[model samples]
Target: MELTCFKAYDIRGELGTELNTDIAYRIGRAFATFLKPKKVVVGWDVRETSPELKDAFAQGVLDFGADVIDLGLCGTEEVYFGTKFLNADGGCMVTASHNPINYNGMKMVRDEAKPISRDTGLADIRKMAETETYSEKAATPGTLTQLDNRAAYVEHLMGYIEFETLKPMKIVVNAGNGAAGPSLDAIEAALKEKGAPIEFIKINHEPDGTFPNGIPNPLLHEQQPVTGKAVKEYGADLGVAWDGDFDRCFLWDEDANFIEGYYIVGLLAEAFLVKQPGAKIVYDPRLTWNTQEIVEANGGEAIQSVSGHAFIKEKMRAEDAVYGGEMSAHHYFKDFAYADSGMIPWLLVVDLLSRKQTTLKTLVEQRMAMYPSPGEINSKVADADEAMARVYDAYKGDAIAEDRVDGLSLEFADWRFNLRKSNTEPVIRLNVETRGDKDLMDEKTQDLLALIRQ
Candidate 1:
């Protein structure tokens, strides 16, 4: 067993190599033993190898005399929904998220959609796998029941937005041939039923295990071109895309301009606060100023957290936060069991546009101009710590203030920069932003890159 597969948030590795039935069985057994829950729910994506892995994993769970509910061919978010809907003790999702076709992994959640992080049980699972603690088989195998909730999931999301209050808008939706197509199909009809003025131009709506259109990761620059082209080709008001498992979502405004997830965080915070004033809004530490301003302006409390869904969800539950957003495109909601929902954010935002009678660009343009961002820049360096240390040393004393919440964050009077090492990759992610000072942000970004290169 490769202990490295146990990541900060979930277990992931190359499919046939580091991840296989043997590994899956161990993980299942570990999960069942550790959770010791009465019933465990299981879900998987459309990946070709997901079925076999799911079966093997469930078998491990049953060996421990824990019943398993198999939620077939669903997105990871659905697994979250199932955990809460069925009142299960815990759940595991068989997915590698946006990883390449040759990779797969598992994401586990505690009862009521709580996350299982390294601090919780991920490390124990790794240790159990390594130690080969095979428990004695029970007298009877736990039963497995196939279940479907995609329709109910869609219906639940619809309850958040008012279709009769929406205006007809042209929007381009790029599923990237992931698992979002079915959900989007349901949403479109639901919107039409309420007489919404909305038209969807969809691309790569078909789910294909081969990922012929490319991996469903919308973060990569190469993947943006497809959605960007669609936005321009159709002359649409906006474009929305999702990752492989549809856990995170991305947006593009009119004229094919990519909207920063940070800005959307503030926008959604403000929108959600209008209905739930005094509610706490959760945001990652990487992008703080804008989210703080938005929440404070709306009379809502702002809670800063480290990046990743597990950390955000845990904080959201603790703070009883009404909403949470990460610069990485993950958004969480209180209504959805405090779990992140890739579907609801877009739906609510679109509904906001309709209720306000504005375009998506119009809704976000002012905020974008107020806080120009350098966008997240990924640098592949020999040593991430060395690169981050060099960058930090250069700016530490010079900056007005510094923070080590998630990584190294330096705040100047009018600008700021965050340099953090990736949890899963040998790289450093650098994000710089300025208070309406694009030239200064650009110049400082280059200077930091030069320092890292040195």
Candidate 2:
């Protein structure tokens, strides 16, 4: 039994062929056997298969004598929150995130919401699941309990921003028909109770597993325009969109411009630094100039971590970072058990808008101008290594410095680019940035794309 569903960081597979209730049960049993957890937290997204899978996984835990605390119908971060909040020994979230409609997956974590990446304990879980070897069952099975922590979680989120500072604003929130709808509704109710004077114009805000609209991934250039158009039509102060599981969030400006996640990183770094000066900020290596400058200029320390949620969380714990952000829209906070949250970023951004008396565009425009980037570009190729080799060979002579922290990063005086092969696909991603030269950035992006696709 080779578990083809196990990936580098989590579990993901298509229906019937790779994953089903049986495999999910085995995984739950294996998870319990490996961790010997006294209690486990479980949650699932809006995927049609997710409820059955969650029940199967929870049964495995119960059979192994570990109690289950089920937080029904929630996002991935909610499991992270529940694990730490309930003092559970481990947690699992049944969610495929931004994957296709036919796909489903699970993300696991240990006590205190620590991630279970391949290096930590995922490999051992996979092996145990494949072998189907389990410890003896207890005489009496563990009990199952249902808990709704939405109110507590919303309070925790609201703690990140001051209600008094929030001004009158109209915003568009597109849930893309995923699990975020219910949670967003809870937050909206909380805001109204406090008289926050914020108007939310919702779109595709139902939890439909069929995804009546396309999959809820705003990272796709084509999917972004829907939210952007809504922002313009509503005359919104800003717009926010989330993926299926709502772990990563994308933003749009007042004029309906899609703001790249790179610029948001800089904006957020400055926000944190303003309150807690001299704090450490962890950032991914894909786009560096803007984040580096902002962190340094604001009297904060900037640290670079290899891309990925597990790696970023590990680095944040080691460095005791105040915040960590990836160019792909993942933002982590220290107070949130070092877990990434799609909900926190927007709240904090809106709070900043009210406090600074500025718009999202104004806050990020100067930084965007200072460090121009075309965002991340992915190219599918026959050989990822060969494509990278060709790009490196073409620019090695003129490169002043090179860093291979997560991938290949070449830096010159005015511009730099990072090229890395995708972990889960036969594609290579390229990110290029220049110092205040959009034309140069565009030219280099085109040059690199030609080389990568050739």
Candidate 3:
């Protein structure tokens, strides 16, 4: 009973063959058996199979004598929030999060919302699930209860910004028919109650598991234009789009330009520094120049961490950092139990706009020019390890500095690039950046691609 659904960070699998109610129940029982949690929080997304899966998982927990608090339909962050807010022993979210419509999965976290990765607890859970050995059922099974923590979650988001300072603005929000619709509605309702003059023009606002408008992943180049076009048509001050689970968010500017997450990391570093100078900010090593410069100039310390939510969260807690961001649109905050949130990033950006009295383009354009990057490019390879080795061998001669913190990162005087194998797929990911030289960035990007693909 090897579980193909278990991945590095979470659980994901194709329906029927790899994952069904039985496997889900086994995982639930295993999770309870390993942690021996007294109480657990559970939630699901918009996928049609998610409700049944959640029910099955909850029953397994109940049979193991662990109480279940079911949050009907919500994003992944809500479970992270509920775990800490309710003081539950653990939490689980049933969602595939940007995977195809035929897929579904789950994410689990322990007390205080600590992530459960393969290194931490997932491997043990998988082994226990496979063995099918558990303690006898409790004499009286644990109770089941329903809870709606949206209002409290929305209030927690509001605490990140000062609503009184918010100015009149129009924004475009595209939920892409995922679980984000309901959560965004709660935020909008809170904003309206506060008499904020922000206007939200919604698109694909319903939660449809069919994904009528394609997957909600705005990270794809093709998936970006829809949000950008809406920004221009609505004359919006900013544009935002979210994936199925709404853990990562993508942004668009006033000119309908898709702003890369690298620049947003720099912008956010500066924003947080303004409020709390000398704060520690954790960033990924893939893109360093922009975030490094901004953090240093703002009287703050910049620390580098390997890319991934679990690694970043662990580092933030270790250093007690103020904020952490990755180039993949995942942003973590110290106050949110070191969990990433899609809603909080945009709200903080809006606050920055109001406080700085500037547009989104004005804030990030200079930084983009200062450190030009083409964003991350992925190429499918027959062997990801061999491709990375080939790229490194070709460039190691002229490289002044080399790092393997997460993957291969080689730096030269004028430009640098990081090439790493994808943890979830058979692809090589490349990120190249130059010092204020777009042509060099372009030329090097092509050269690297040629070698990587050859």
Candidate 4:
């Protein structure tokens, strides 16, 4: 019963300690027994331990007589896509994502790429993995094969854009020495093969698990300047960077300004609405004014969901939403099995630019001006519960409205803020936004931080 790596949504733990090859083999056996999947697709990121761990998991699956399709070093979403694309029974991605290099994890999916979170059988899997009471291996061990899913995966991504009409655009892609490099290269090569009007300026484009440059997380304030500088240096039309697994991508405008993922939600909502009016667009509760405005203005329904990929995907399926986005840079598409993709968003943005004959700056400048946001800011605290309560008490009186959809969100006449505790870490994330008032956004953010720290 010693299981330290299992989590609410996926499996994550430090290498050689909480997770090792033996545990991985047991997890694979547990998954095969639990899901009884006829075919399982497995992939791993570019972490040092990933290959050995992935092989162990594959062996476990084979022991249970489930066929295994080994997807070599790739992004997490590729596992999601491959599950459905190949009509496999289930899939797993060995990746720590943007976590520190010492850490590693797994993301699993069921038939049709439906996620397998703790609530949806991960808990039982965890127990089986802990107890090692898996059913006896099949009389005939399952078959194993290797697959190159990149070409098909690239084609699937390019399907989202109309290439013939695309205008020439210079894009800077910083892979941050993660698994994103190969996929981007494939897509760029395919685009060139078709003679599409696009230019790629790649930086830190190699996939090195050592992370020679740094971890590929663009969300960090310190990491923002890297892509910004690359954009300015290349004079690129836009800049994009992916996390360790490339499941999430961060962006920068032509002016080297880092655009908050919240605004990208609005920008994308607007783009999808133009094509499929009246479609439902799902967004998180962290920051809502801009998303709500854009969705409503574009004649689409704006549905709010709790954050995290599992929650958003669940909501997207339930509502049949066309698109769902979290301000944290995870974007889900209906056509994409309601799974998030770091690649799809940038492609969609490029299409929007070509269709509108304008810059990313223009597309988002108005929305940003209409409702300025300070973005999500995280603060470490001794007790997150106490901090949340104190902030609620201080602002509840002046608030015109409030909701606890995902967290404590207080709305005033001119500005609103949401304070939510991190599910994975002991920190409270605060986001402040106002109606065209940068000063108000600035003042309220600092004020809330002071109160939280107090």
Alpha carbon lDDT of each predicted model: 0.87, 0.94, 0.93, 0.92
**Model 4 lDDT per residue over 204-264, tens place:** 9988989887777888889889999989998999999999988898889999999989999
Q: Least accurate stretch of 10 residues (summed lDDT) in model 4? A: 212-221
TM-score of each: 0.97, 0.99, 0.99, 0.98
Q: After superposition, how far is residue 317 of candidate 4 from its true place, in Å?
A: 0.5
- The C-alpha stretches of model 4 lying farther than 4 A from their native spots are none
Cα RMSD, each candidate: 1.5, 0.9, 0.9, 1.1
Q: Give me the runs in candidate 2 sitting further than 4 Å from their true place.
A: none
Query: Per-residue lDDT of 1-454 in model 2, one digit per residue for the tens?
Result: 9999999999999989889999999999999998999999999999999999999999989999999999999999999999999999999999999999999999999999999989998999899889998776778899999999999999999887888888999999999999999999999999999889899999999999999998899988889999999999989999999999999999999999999999888888888999999999999999999999899999999999999999999999999999999999999999999999999999989989999999999988888899999889889999999999999999999999999998899999999999999998889999999999999999999999999999
Quote the lDDT for 228 in model 2: 93
Error at 379, model 1, angstroms = 1.5
Of the candidates shown, which would achieve the greatest lDDT relative to the real structure?
2
Candidate 4 similarity to native, TM-score: 0.98
- Superposed on all Cα atoms, model 3 deviates from the true structure by an RMSD in Å of 0.9
**Per-residue alpha-carbon lDDT of model 3 for 158-213, expressed as tens digits?**
89878778888898999999999999999999999988788999988999999988
Count: clashes, candidate 4 = 0
**Which regions of candidate 3 deviate over 4 angstroms?**
none
